[model samples]
Target chain A: MREPISIWCFSGVLLFIYGLLIFASGLWELAHPLLHPPVLHQLHAPIWWGAILTVIGLWYLIEFWPHKRASQPKE
Target chain B: MFPATNLWMVSHLAGMVAHPQSGLIAAITPSGMVRLSPVDLIIIAVYFVLVVFIGFYLKESSNTGEDFFMAGRQMTAWIAGLSFVSANLGSLELMGWAGSAYQYGILATHWYWIGAIPAMLFLGIVMMPFYYISKVNSVPGYLQLRYGPATRALSGITFAVMTILMSGINMYAMALVMKVVLGWDLNFSIWVSAITVAAYVALGGLRSAIYNEVLQFLLIWAGSLLVPILGLIEVGGWRNLEKQIIHNVGQTGYLHMWTTLGHFNTNPMGVNWFGIVFGLGFVVSFGYWTTDFLVVQRVLSADNLRSARMAPILGAAFKMMVPFIVILPGLLALSVLPFKLVAQDIAVQTGQHSFNEVLPLMLVRYCGPGLLGLGVTALIAGFMSGMAGNVSAFSTVWTYDLYGAFMNKKASDEHYVKMGRWCTLIGVLVSIGTAYLVQHAASIMDYVQALFSFFIAPLFGTVLLGMLWRRATAAGGFWGLLSGTLTSFGLWEWVERDPSALRYVALSPDAKAMAQDIFRALWAWVVCVIVTVVVSLLTKPRPVAELEGLVYGVSPIPEEHDDHWYQRPMVWAGVVFAVFVVLNVIFR
Candidate 1:
């Protein structure tokens, strides 16, 4: 149970999504010069970093939350 | 060929040739045996014996995992205070500062005060309360309390990787200094120091590291102070050195603090004041103070919250004194020896290896013999303490946060104690590989900063949201972490490709400035807090207990949680902030 759970998190579907965006941005830069050439390389940067921050945000929302108010006590 | 020859025009022409200013060039005679005598060997042996003896004396008390990690969690403010400063003030500052001051002109000193001094103050006061009250093993472990097991485990692995990487860099950086100063073989120093640090750290954990840190701190301060004093006298006093530098550079504004600085964004190649502060100083100072486990473990082990808070405060106090030792010597080195010359001297002194030769080269040429040995020993002391601190934290994290938390939460104190030693051994071995690989890698500081950004930024998000916002969920933590990482790195990669973004990245002329800026942004503690706070406000609220912990402290599990500051955490946090601000103003 623990092994699978940890692995799923590491693979991180969202991280992949961000990586794809960066790849696209890089490709975009190679094809078309937008703004300065320097600015173009910068375009890919935010996706992965943004993805990283988003993941952190979601985790904080989940962990500190109290267990849903019980319908009936376990006891 | 020209109409008239003015000195400033001559310098400006030379500056055009170099494309900025006249750079330093090294003067050295290579192909000679190191000055390391049997007396030097004896000095090393005696230092080793004392350090090891301290480890053994402290080891019996380190019978439990808790004792090994947090010194039975009985640490006081002052000990934690000094150890923190000692860990940071190392070969990096010594070599990097000298190298930069020599090459870049007067801009190096500005990098220290503006980039690090304030960041240290803000982090020391604002973040200390959380760590003191929460009492976790690694900075990531704090995340587990706020997020979930997955985030905690991720934090653990990354923290371990980052520490080992830094240890490897430190290993290489230290050996480089030795090679330059003592004229020893680079390979020889690296191999010997790696073994020495591993052996000592594997035997004793944070206790040994912290205890030894007290000694290193003293040596670092003494040797650092001694070097400049002697060098100034040797060069016919500060008056001559200062005059020569002003004449050579042809611009005295570099000496002025109020001079606005620029960075990659504005300058493309260098940084100015804005970049130094928001970029280098704000980012790196916060990351190290708030997130890095090597320093935090000392505070977390404190007897109570009061002691923990004081550690960073005192460390910052000491940080304010750094320019005296590291920065000023670098400035002195700049005036006396050009960087190019220093580089060549380092090569001759350190056998023509890479950057490792810079510091030791300066030491040998500049300082006299007795002081030379003392400075060399101090370098060793600085490095050993750093290696010890990292290995100690690594061992504790592996044993408690992972081994205990996952494999055997129910294990006895005895089992955990034994596990701690094994953990440290594993951690040290990992560092050996990292050090071996790091010699060939890019700038050690940059690589370390990059690795840290991956974990520390996200973990910072988890904890901040957990503390400041009640609605922060495990899911929220997960999302926030992912978001903040992408944001900071987005900034990082953008800067990397454009190079102009480097202005925002480090915004300092020196590696330490760059390191500090990148350190600050990579973690992006501010981004984490702001995002977590605003996001949580828009979301639902957590139960009262969770909110209470956000305000107060991580409450002990299996209780309703009373009196421990969870309910009134805001009051305490406000107090920490006010004190931090006051310290900054007075110190500045």
Candidate 2:
């Protein structure tokens, strides 16, 4: 049950990508002030994308919402 | 502009409110609250007396580990609900976030409207079913059942880290406030607040803490609520105050953080919509609402699962009401006083604190003594209740999870309870000491929450996969936990750490102006969840039988649940989701 190297790699790649995104975002910031999005646009841009992911994940969860509980477990 | 004498209970309370005409807020406290005034010291005495007495009152119940840890599992729904909400509110929320509200505007609390309230409700109905089906001693134990031991241990340890990090900062903050508001020596204030809270926590464990928290919560609320009411009256009334706010904001909505005006100066944490939703809303709310140990223990300790579920949901309602009392005054402080400090967050300050100085500057400058005492008492109550909750939660983690689980396995229930007392003593001392380390953090609010957020999200990955993924292997689960944490930390230090790193992403103009980098912190959560799941999927699955008990909360009694909560998660979820759409549409 110990974790595999893949999990770590997965984590590492994410960090790298986020760092990568930040690196990319830095290019954006360096461009200087742009128009502020409308209030709703301002709030939901991150949310809509995150929600898309979350809903997809949650959809996976709903399919097995009532999955049976196992009486036996690994200690 | 005439003040409303009806709600204006405290005299001179208006002195601190910001007004364009006025040069400064808290202008009356220009001289600073003189040393431990007899009135301030008396408030301390009354607080100790009531708290200590309650400690003894609940001592009989603390004779067992169950009593110490879960208040003997007999807590009523209302109390548990209130306690859950109150405990989650550390000193920082009142002093720090409120300050943010004051600096920014009312829209900051919008996170509660969209994010927190729904999440709490989701946990209420969605989680209660699973919780009722499984009778676990803790959230991690449930993780062990659904996921595997590796996942269990990972979840347990991560939660403990979260508790320590959060509790540690909370401890630091309360002491800092005491020093500032009471004008006591820093060391003395830290020790006093820590030791005082620890004593009651040790005396009766969660029960004592919970009960004391109720009193403290009410007191704090009274104090928080009093600030703006008194201020508006003193400013000559809301008409004048609104003028100041409209003047300060101009064209932009001052009550909202919607505008991209100066980014760094406002929303310093970069708590834009995404940060609020994903960082605080989804990641923080889901992770904490569903799984945080401090919150879970309170619910589990309740008399019934129904109450347990109701506690958080009810608590959510209470939390939503908070912006009215706490944040409004902060905004009022801005309009009445005019803004000076961006990072003027109370928790960020060290050495010199005058919490009483927040409201009393008005009393000292504009009002009289009688009202000041009442307002001061309320503030103290707010501070102490929050501090007490932290001390209590810390001891539970140390005792039940660390001490009883590892150090003293065979100790009888009585001995376990006694050990909890010792843990409380040590936990308090350490926390007080840890408070000193917090100021050194980048932004006490951002640094600690982000640290926890980076590490904690992987947990969501493991738990979700473990319960839902039949193919999820013990190996995968374990690996995911480790990898998730490593990835989060690695990203935090490497990419997000560089101010220039996230400088490239094309964001709204307002996003670019932010003082702190929000992208990196957001990425940490994303990466951790991804690695945990992928690794779990790629790795081997546990034997179905072995994974059985872990996935579902199976118990001998077939955990009883009311039919009422089970039928309507969709309704709740749908309503909440629709609101999200509407908020965007209307606000758009």
Candidate 3:
């Protein structure tokens, strides 16, 4: 009954991509504080948010990897 | 030559000082909304790309009519539940009710709780068994089963028209927000959102729409959670927010829910407790949560009877908490954000007491660039989820119930699937046109509520009677529906004909449009019930065999999958009821 694509798989991929972007942004902002506007220069919300996204994305990915593998052999 | 960055900053500061209030608050201008940093743009681009990817990804698997329209009946409880509530959590619900909370105070929470929970529980425990067991693909399809084709056609066409019009209203509402926040061209905003929704909906069908809705639910939560959290922190927590709001608004009633609701004069809602409990909580709320196809369609896509029934219960649990995300921002706006500045332009656009830019203003104040993009994206996600909900429901009803049933009954399933796609395209285009038409009308929230009173309230009455009463004849159903609809119109028209007439019913002169909507729904429900009962008794009832799976008493009940006592629907209902009482008592 497994479809070719499900919401969980794509949610993982997309969340991963989004997490990667936030993580990179957090690193970049932390490395070069002068480039960012003063309002955003000091806030660590991005770093924390990015870390949360990373953890969530990894969980979805780990959960989905086996399902994808199981369905691949049938295809 | 280009201006220096320093010079541009100086000019921006000067512009802020030139505003009515002298502070760092920038006047909402076109460039300010669109002038996202590189990181912000990248984030939004990623979101859109992922959304389109999800849409087309599911398209390949959806080959059959069932797959296209109903997700092949494979949705789990959480998916169905989330999509059910998310579909209802559209831009109108978020932006409109948030603004209502600002204007009407904590009493607006009534729409979230008392107005929703009881009816949602009713739908879950009592009504869904019939819907799932009867195996109707759409609500109109159910009508066709219960009352015959005449009732189906009437309900079908009314629902189809209402869905498209409501979809267009969502488009229009979103465009209004964009124009106010981003200063984007109205037509451009409408087309961008319309095209995006149409593309995904047409590509992947209901499955795609539901999947994206779940995603939007998460995004909305992620994006909006910070506003209340930060707002609470900035205001020194909930107690401080209450005190500051009272000081700023000069009213203690804004902090309490039921205390001021004793009379219209005492409440900011301008609605007495009787009107709040009966008009909204009973009639309007039941009419909408119990019967609206846009929401019911999500639950209908569930895998089995248990999932279908549990969907709304799960939805009700989540639904009870939504006021925190949507309404809290409005409450925060009353204290943390300056009223005079944000109210300047939105007041002109919406023709309301305060600016409806509560959420957007709060976002601007609290979020910096990176988080700002995520916040705005969440708002966009909300708008798109709503549009998708409307368009997808419209396409299904148009394809299965209207086009498939009436125009060509003998078509193949594949043919119907193709037709559904075409209808999705056409539905979005029609909504775009309707969005433009709605620009000249009054506020989006008021217009939407009035339409619900006219259409959904009556429809709910007919549906409630048909499901519970097997003796109810088809002739009774048809006439009851017709009478209920006409009565709502007649009452609304009478009020419009003489503006002073509302006072005769003890309505305040400055009562919000929602009050009138409540009264109209109450009267319409009464009319529908009366006409239906009177007509039903005069006609011969359908045979018990014909009513077996469709009616409450004669229907062979399905076995409960919930082997454990805690999993029972009644237990969940009781738990939800207890929590609702606790919330009311605490907020009261």
Candidate 4:
């Protein structure tokens, strides 16, 4: 029987996807600044925030990878 | 008058401005406000797809009634713990409390701290054993075991109705927020979110709801954490923020939690320490945290007695940190926002921003496209997860306590599972109906929310007595719960008819509407305890043998065999309590 998927694995993938998108958008904004950027736009919050999310997502993915072995569903 | 009445006026005014029927949507130009870019839209779309995928992924495992309703009782403490807290972390609460913080200052933090932490620890260490060992499917199921079918039925019906109605109110509130913040259509937001929540909850049952709640918890942090971080950085540090607030508001009282709480008139909330402790901390908080089935259902999904007990303690730890994301933004808004935020009515009339817009305003102030989308998605996720929690709990109680217990006792497991699924759909539909009803009348929203206060305090009194005291009779439990609920309702009516009655109910003419709510819960609980003791002594008690697992003294609690001291619920609860005291002291 196939092993049940865990919530951590799902969260990992979604966070990675969102982080990558946000990171790319943050880089693009840095290159081509808007007419009126947000208050703390100079801080490039998106880049750092995206990096943090990516790191956390990657850590979750590696730690909670759904291997073929029979395992309890640990969320 | 009442806070709910104030909310109704706000919601009604927002509805009038946003409703398509009023032709004001075009005039208001919601698109003129914070508009989501393609990146933001993609982020939101991705969230929706993932949640639905999770629903379909968990469908196979949810075939059985136990699996569907209880996640097969196989959740880890972290999963159950996060879900437990996240279930209560609704968008309405996030936004409303942020507004409250803006309006009431640091005093608002009491709801997340004193009003929550101790009660949560009590639930984990004291009450969880009775709930976990009794092997009940729902809170009403426990009532059936402890009291009788009559008490169970009354509790179950009220819970089921209140849950469904509250779900609808949440739905409407979310749509209202989306309209006010993002220029989304009311029906569009309502139908889309309702359909998604209904589909996922129906497909995956409790497991789906629980998993989504965990995910929502993370998303909320991911989305909103930037606000305080950026705001603090912008306005220097915490000390500077305090200076800015004092400079802005012309008072240091807004920054102190306990000092200003000595007198009702000293604090922005117009509530005193006595009300804060006995009324909110003891009665309201315990009632909601310990007995409200919406949260308890999550803890009940824990795999073992140890995990079940640890879940709320873990939740309390995380809950203590929530004010950073929720309340701090409001304080930041008070200091940093360029314009003053008026009351909802004043905002509507004068085209000024209202207090409720603080969170979104802060998000917009700090976040551009990609980040803006994340924040909006977090709000949407909070709303959807809250709706899912309500629908899932409603289905379980409706199927098990109401239908299975009363209507068809001999139904097969498969039949009940099918009924549970149907109940989810029905509950969502009913919620949708209630949303439309609120959009039309708006006043009904106030009354529906008031329904929660009526039952929760008295129910807690009954449940606590039933679990602790062996002599608490079935008749005593039923009468106590009924009278407590009626007393709360009667008090609410009295205050509604005569506004000056707040002086009597809240123990001070100076006490505001918020204080009235706290004292009302306290009085209702007192009335319940007195009536319960009188009736229980007069009525014959159940044999100790029959009450073994249900009552504390008669029942033998299962010993938690932890491998280390760190794993003990008591040690961690003690740690959490110590931190709780320090936080109160620091904030005081």
By DockQ, the best candidate is: 4
Clashing pairs in 4: none
Q: What TM-score does candidate 4 get on C-alpha atoms?
A: 0.96
Instruction: Candidate 2: list runs displaced more than 4 Å.
Output: A1-75, B1-31, B34-41, B165-168, B230-243, B257-272, B338-371, B436-450, B495-497, B504-521, B543-588
Q: Residue by residue across B283-401, what tens digits does model 3's lDDT show?
A: 88888887888889999999988889889999999999999977898888888764443443443343332434566667766666667777777778888888898899999999988
lDDT per residue for candidate 1 within B433-522, as digits (tens), equals 766665555344454665566555456456655665556766666666666766666766676677655444554334333443344454
TM-score between candidate 2 and the true structure: 0.72
- Writing each residue's lDDT as its tens digit, candidate 4 over B396-491 gives 999999999999999999999999999999999999999898888877866876888899999999999999999999999999999999999999
Show model 1 residue runs off by greater than 4 Å: A1-75, B1-34, B183-187, B234-241, B262-269, B338-358, B440-449, B457-462, B490-539, B549-588
Ranking by TM-score: 4, 3, 2, 1
Per-candidate RMSD, Å:
19.7, 17.5, 6.6, 3.0
Give the CAPRI rating of model 1: incorrect
Q: State the TM-score of the second chain for every model.
A: 0.79, 0.80, 0.91, 0.97
Looking at model 2, give its docking quality level.
incorrect
Provide the lDDT at A26 for model 2: 29
How many clashes show up per model? Answer: 88, 44, 0, 0
| Lowest summed lDDT window (length 10), candidate 2 chain B | B1-10
DockQ-wise, the better of 3 and 4 is 4
DockQ of 2: 0.01
Q: How far out, in Å, is residue B566 in model 3? A: 2.5
True A-B contacts kept by model 1: 0.00
